[model samples]
Target: MTPPKTIRAAAIQVEARVADIPWNIEHASRLVDEAVDRGAELVALPEFFTTCIVYDERVFGCSLPPENPALDMLKEKARRHRIHIGGSYLEMRDGDVYNTYVFVEPDGKVHRHDKDLPTMVENAFYVGGDDTGLMETSLGPVGAAVCWETVRTQTVKRLRGKVGLLMTGSHWWSEPGWNWARGYWQRFHAGNGRLMERTPRTFASLIGAPLLHAGHASVIEGGFLVLPGTRLTAPIRTQLMGETQVIDGEGRLLARRRYQEGAGVAVADLQLGAVQPRAESPPRFWIPKFSPMLYFQWYHQNAAGKSAYRWAKRTGRLRTWDDGRNARAAAERL
Candidate 1:
């Protein structure tokens, strides 16, 4: 077997507007251009980079086919730049909507992996996807885990010793009370912030490969409110934002663009040739704190809920993302 080759990689961080395809595509294209100018041979974009999220009725209306126009735009960018590009998008296949990652070769050939599971609020919008998450590229074997999927025990375990690089695209929400509290805790605790600052380091260490994490940095105005609680004196608007980070096989941070730093590109050299896959124990299952979302997900996957879901789809009653009011109501239903 041949050793993995060294590759210069870049992670682009940009805020995407929900349902705004043109603006998101433009910004992502410019960021990829910036990375290429910085001598990056591989560039990655954040999850749902083209259209952040739409949970209500819009989600059903906005799902894209495999050969959708958005993909054509991304493929063109990869071909124009002659660089490997990794990105995730919302896809509708058969009757399911998926959070899917696509790896575009310099020749514009695209490979894809669906997220194994959706996290928290995401379950209301996307159905889980099934793919190996592993791919062979000119740079060497590469793997991907999307947003919250990175925290799963089996997600990275499946790629261990099988890939030289692992690409993670995320849209981790950041705000004052909730998100800030978690990030603060993550500094002292290893298992606290799996969706954000810790994923690249954790995946790299466990998978024995370099990991590139591209995340959103721009804040979008939304009706998402952090209700007053014992932790906070008053309600605050929830903002979605995070850092773009990269780490090497030894779990060393190579580069990063923090939330405070605003939108930017992160570049680092992945020394795949030096990687030595180390043996590690399989991660144990983590029991998350109880939440209404989990119960809703479980119900929806059951036989009775499955029938209701199919009927809703057929009748167009599944449009939970029509507006802020409907969004909240839909979330409660799930």
Candidate 2:
């Protein structure tokens, strides 16, 4: 079936707390209500809307079981508002955690896509998935992706010309703590900001599909690994790079909310259709060029994080969804 010529959609930007599930749910629900009030037929939330992803033990405790409250909220919201809704969350399946996106239709139909790869420190929490992000919905073909997946060439290669709409989210973050070499870090962040702002539109053009991108907007407190084999950690304070936005298949911006603007919803009428590709997929891995710092952090942290993940799993330090939820509930009563 052909999708409507145009549909109003919303991308929700949220200020989520690390390992705070109840607060995040309440905050995101309010934003979802705001989107519906503005006549959005479909609403998307940021990656890990239930809790911010960080290299902390509490973050592992935020993962949910397959049938959990976070997903229930999405389904309830979709049913209540008679609109499509979705976002990514950490899900535990087969004893491993995954960054999973769950999209729900009005009639209670559901679709899921696990992020293909974990980014940097995120590697410590979840394993990657192999499924294509494409889904056949009542509104036609829809695609889902999370964070760095939207910036990779392979993602475009898989979805280009195959979907009418691309729904994605990001948990992109700035460098942690700028105390040392402040000026250099300042310049680095500024450049990263420019790239974040351009990603949505550029990705739309490459995939030849209208895109909805939701993102997180808040500070994150966590620890960075000082080495690969030890538990020594350095304190890191960082902020999420929010670029919640909607853009056309031809790469025209329809609506946007920047990180500095705080939490909100970006609503717009999207012209949905698969159009002629505006840019060819490059023969490289990532679409955007990584700076030296980003390059080093990406490689180094990935190895370090993976090592930590293995240790956590073997030693039974990694919290299961049930274990985490019960612990949080018990704390609430205290």
Candidate 3:
């Protein structure tokens, strides 16, 4: 049988209560079941779906050498569902822990990608990942990013290549505008679009592939205030899982549904080839023609290079200085 040109991809979302391992597994698995039932061959889970927020439980007592419990469980889920199920995880290898996402196919084949650039908070918990962007599978090329990595210029450039569909798991948090109390959440939710609307649209606008941004929707410690003008004791962190949707190459929303926090699956058939070979469009982040060597020079001249720094230390590194000693020294030389 020939493979279908278009693929149905599903993005799974859950409320994700902290440290509820069995519950999180069950709920994410159920989403896979739903996606498969709807004829989806590809499915994606939220960033670190197995663990709650990184600060939640220290990755379940996992230390420098992290154990990949999530990968094993996800593999079981994929085998059971007879579909591809993937999620962010903590991976241990060679005595280093990383924030990684593992993909398990229906046939039990697993592919993994460690977050190439760990966010500030992530760097605290996990070391840097070895690779960036997506993972390829039998269905097609599926790319992934977590949280802030999706916004990086280079990573986003990499994601828009010959990849079939774009998927991302993020704890991308935003303060939902105004909240008065129990009754106030409705108003805040209503304003969420205005507050957190830029990036997701960018996902569709740039990739031309169906994208998913999964996040938690729960009250966190020191959450934002509900009352309009009252000061809250602590700042709470919360996330509302975004709905799965398809976008065409024109950056139009082909389909979108509500963000649900249950055993939920958002389904869309992606025909990636229909949007390519444009004759007159200027290059965005990931255009057909990309030059890394140009960036090598750009970074070398504009950004810090440790070797450059060391070399410049002896030669007097004087591009910009905070301590004023180097600048003052150069002024004296002049």
RMSD of each: 7.6, 1.8, 13.9
lDDT (Cα, 0-100) at 196 in candidate 2 = 93
Give the winner by TM-score: 2
- Candidate 1 on 63-180: residue-level lDDT in tens? 5678866688778877887888888977777767688899998787888999987664455456777777988777777898887666666775678778878888888754323455
Question: Each prediction's TM-score against the native?
Answer: 0.77, 0.96, 0.65
lDDT of 2 at 82: 96
Q: How many clashes would you count in candidate 3?
A: 7
Clashing pairs in model 1, backbone N/Cα/C closer than 3 A: 56-320, 56-321, 57-319, 57-320, 57-321
Q: Rank the candidates by lDDT, best first.
A: 2, 1, 3
How does residue 27 of candidate 2 score in lDDT? Answer: 95
Clash counts for the predictions, in order: 5, 0, 7
Superposed by TM-score, candidate 3 places the C-alpha of residue 49 at a distance from the truth, in angstroms, of: 0.7
Clashing pairs in 2: none
Better of 2 and 3 by TM-score: 2
Off by over 4 Å in 2: 1-4, 327-334
Q: Candidate 1: misplaced stretches above 4 Å? A: 54-57, 175-195, 221-236, 277-282, 287-312, 317-334
> What is the C-alpha lDDT profile of model 3 across 1-334, one tens digit per residue?
1133666777766666555555676767666677788887767787767555433322323321233445666677677767677778655566455667777788888877788765433433455676755666776777777755655556656666456566676654433323446455554455544333445556555655556555544444423222222222234455544544445445555545445444466677755542342222234543233235334423432222222223333443222112233456789999
